[model samples]
Target chain A: MDFKLKIWRQKNRDDRGRFVDYEVKNVSPDASFLEMLDILNVDLVKRGEEPVAFDHDCREGICGSCGLVVNGRSHGPGRGIATCELRMRGFKGGETIVAEPWRAKSFPILKDLIVDRTALDRIIAAGGYISSKTGAVPEANSIQVPKPAAEEAMDAASCIGCGACVAACPNSSAMLFVAAKVSHLALLPQGKVERKERVLKMIEQMDKEGFGNCSNNYACEAECPKKISVTHIARLNREFILAEIS
Target chain B: MNKFTALYRSSVGKKIIMSLSGLFLCTFLVVHVVINLFLFKQDGGETYNRYSEFMSSNPFIRTIEIVLFAGLIAHVISGTLVWLKNRASRPVAYEMYQLKDNTTFTSRTPMLTASASLVGFFLVIHLRTFWVPNRFWETAPQSNYDLVAAAFSDPVYSLFYIVALVFLAFHLRHGFQSGFQTLGLSDKQYKWLIDSVAVIFWLFIPLMFAAMPAYFLWFK
Candidate 1:
């Protein structure tokens, strides 16, 4: 198959970005989107042009580094799948694919589709963990976490920190990301001691990092590769309210 | 108050404000439309003109009018702030992509259509007839009815009013359910019911108002 790509390119954070169109031909339908980009980069190298810069560690999609707004959706048109897992078969032959960086103030464009997603790391660092001593490991059965709570916390914990939520959010809010982190620890008994401080600090950090407020549009959930429910946002709100009282 | 500030600081605060203000406005529409229906008087011995006169003289109702303007100002100002803040939250992605149909069209386009309705008719025709003349309330209610008829006589005025009502129908449809959601009333079990009711209210109220002018101008 063949595709025409209008890919966003920029030299640095301050540089004005624009789309540079390129055509890739004879691509395999089974290849991942990143693999297709690799093929295109190979062509660019052969012609003595600068290779397109993008981030991808685990091409299997778990790393969450490979995100793009393909044809105007995070991680392309696939559901519950990351960009690395998205394949060429999703598009028809000779289709013109538009690829751009996520448009969020918090995720500034670094260079050529690469964005600074350090804001997410800052939120996680705020209080996304269980605050405990690093001594001997406690027995697993010591804390009696309800089966449902544990399961739900595990589900919330599944967020891969891909920044897709921010990308898809109309307000560029990181509420989904913050909510996921807050819910993950807040739902478990082990983290309950610090749950109040956890949510408060996380939200403060999110806002300080320049993330926008949630618009309740649910666009973030729709585009999230993990399909993180907005219900977590409700959980986050509840936690925040309780924290304020405390 | 600090707690309130926290709530206001978050997205839910803005949403709550939008929803509450929207619901308030929705109630205003119902009552306003119902009152306007009185203008459909058949010119009997006692009619809408009397109702209008009663409303004009009531001091209690005048106080309510002040509250109504306050609500309008809060609703519009807060709504615009939230909308603009939401807009700036994320930069627009590539514009060529199609939007999903999941959210109501009216919810997405409230400001657009609402502005059109306000600008096209409400600012000029409505103020002129209802607001400009101090007599809107001063004259015994019959003059208000006469003014309504006078305004509806021009096809342009009538057409713009009808167009504005159509937009209000669109606004109210999403505004109703969305308002409930921000008030924390959105639950899975009653979501569909809420949606259906909203659609009905939106359509029925606006149609009732539009029917008044269309009927009065064309028939009576």
Candidate 2:
């Protein structure tokens, strides 16, 4: 198969980037999106041209590293999948695909199709962890987590720290990601100890990061690869209110 | 910043203010629409003027009026802040963003749509045409219906009012459920019910409002 790819290219953070279109021919239908990029990069290298750069690791959608706004939707088209999981068969042979980096004020472009996503790490570092006594591993039955709470916590925990939620957001808000972490831990008994300060500090840090606020458009939910529910956002709001009042 | 200042400055805090003030304004629309319906009574605006008189003179209602304005102010302030900050969050524009693929068409941003810029503009003109003349200019209760009918008489202003009501429908279409989502009450169970009820406020209120002007302009 053959396709036209409009790829973004930049030297570094200070450089102004633009979309440079290229045509790739004779690609396998079964290749993942990243593998297709690899084929293009090999061709570019053979021709003594700079290859397009993007982040990817597991190629299995679990790493949360590979991200792109393909044809306008984050993580390519459809729902519940990452860019790495996108297959060439999803597109027509002669399709013109526009691949752009995640655009957010906080996530600056480090190179072509690569963004500085450390801001997300800073948000997680703010309070996404629970403090527990370091000792022998406790018995599994000791925690006594309820079934519903466990399900909620597990669901929230599925978030892979991917910034697709941010990329897909109209406001570029990280509320969905922050809410996922907040709700996940807040539901567990172990996460209850620092619930109040945790949410407060995390939100303060999120504000300092210069990301936008949630307009409740649910675009983040729509674009999320894990299909992270917006219900966690509601939980985050409830948690914030309870923490403020109590 | 102090605790309250910090809270108010945060995005979540500002949204809390937006939701509360927006819903307050939404409630005000209901009361205003329901009362305005009295204009259609066959008694030639007698009942409409009576309620209008009571609303104007009663100290309690007047006090509530002040609170209502306060809510509007708060809502506008937070909305403006959200729009400004969110605008700053995306300095670079996308070369090809098919927003329709991912999100609904109702103002992709909140304040840009639901939070009121057009509706606010219509409101200033609306109050100048009717409320100001009725309240401060000494247009007595007897002339109240005359005030409304006379204003709706102008084709341009009447058309503008109706156009603005359409935008209000677009506004509330997102605002009603959005307010619930912001309040953290957006449980899956509540969403179906909240969304169902939301259609009424977003549609009914505006249709009822637009009907008045459309009625007076063409039929009356």
Candidate 3:
């Protein structure tokens, strides 16, 4: 298969970016989207041209390091899979695929397809952690978490912190990401010590980061690579309200 | 900032105000629809006129009107601010923006503010026609029913009413559950019920309101 790619190219964060057209020929249908990009970069290098720059760590979707809005979708055509998981088979032969970096005020474009996502890390740093002193590895069963609560917490814990939610959101809201972090800890017994303070500080950080507010669009959940639920956002709302009242 | 100021300044705080004001307006819609139903009584607007007279003349109802006005102002102002801020958050636009899965027309559009603005325009004409005349202008039409009936008799006015109600319905459809969501009432347990009620409220109330003009213009 072959694809005509219109990829956003930026020399650096300070450079004004523009879309550059490139062609990848003899691409394997089984190749992941990132692998196809790698083939294109190899071609560009052989031609003595600057290769397109994109971020990737684990080709597997878990690291949340790889992201590009392929043909106007966050992690490409399919939900619940990162860009590294998307296959070339998803597109037709000789199709023109447009790839761009995540567009958000908080997430600035650093290069061709990589945007700085440290704003998310800052939000997590604000309060996405439990602060228990680590003396030894404690027995997991001592806290006695209920089955349902544990399951719910684990579900919320699945967010990979990719900014797809922000990119896909019409408002560029990071509510889903923040909500996942807030709910994962709020639902667990181990995280209850600073639950009130956790939600408050995290939300304050989220606001300060210049992310938009959730307008109940549900695009975040729809486009989430991890398929995180918007219900977590509702739970976050509940937690914030409870924190305020308390 | 103090907690109160912080709450008022935050996005969530503005949303809470919108929710509360929207819920109040939703309640007012129910009452408005109920009273408007008196139009279909077939008493040549006698029953409807009497109800309107009592509602307009009652001191308690008048005070509630003030509250209703305040709620409208708050909902509109806060919603506008949130919309502007949300727009500003994304300084850049996607070249090929596509709606992802589960996104509805109502969800993507500025249905609340846009429809509210349309409804607000209709409200101005409605007030000039019915409210202003009925309240302050002593020499205006004696019966509220006659005024409404005459207005609906004009095809353009009736069509405008019907169209305005449709926009109001779209606004309410999104607004109802959104209000509850902002208030933290959209829990796993009650979300189904709240969504069901919202569907019914948006559909049923607007249909009922639209039926009044339909009845006066065509059915009668």
TM-score of each model's chain B: 0.84, 0.94, 0.94
Off by over 4 Å in 1: A127-154, A183-201, A234-246, B1-11, B41-47, B50-60, B90-96, B100-104, B109-128, B131-137
Give the alpha carbon lDDT tens digit for every residue of A1-246 in model 3. 999999999999999889999999999999999999999999999999999999999999999999999999999898799999999999999999999999999999998899999999999999999898767988888779999989999999989988899999989999999999899998888788899899888888888989989788788999999899888888888888888878
lDDT to native, each model: 0.76, 0.89, 0.88
TM-score of each: 0.85, 0.97, 0.97
- For model 3, the stretches where C-alpha displacement exceeds 4 angstroms are B110-113
Residue A47 lDDT (model 3): 96
- Ranking 1 against 2 by TM-score, winner: 2
lDDT of 3 by residue, B71-91 (tens): 999988988888888988888
Tens-digit per-residue lDDT, A179-214, candidate 2: 999999999999999999899988888889999988
How well does candidate 1 score on lDDT at residue B181?
53
Worst 10 residues of 3 chain A by lDDT: A133-142
Using lDDT as the yardstick, the better of models 2 and 3 is 2
Lowest-sum lDDT 10-residue window in model 2 chain B: B107-116
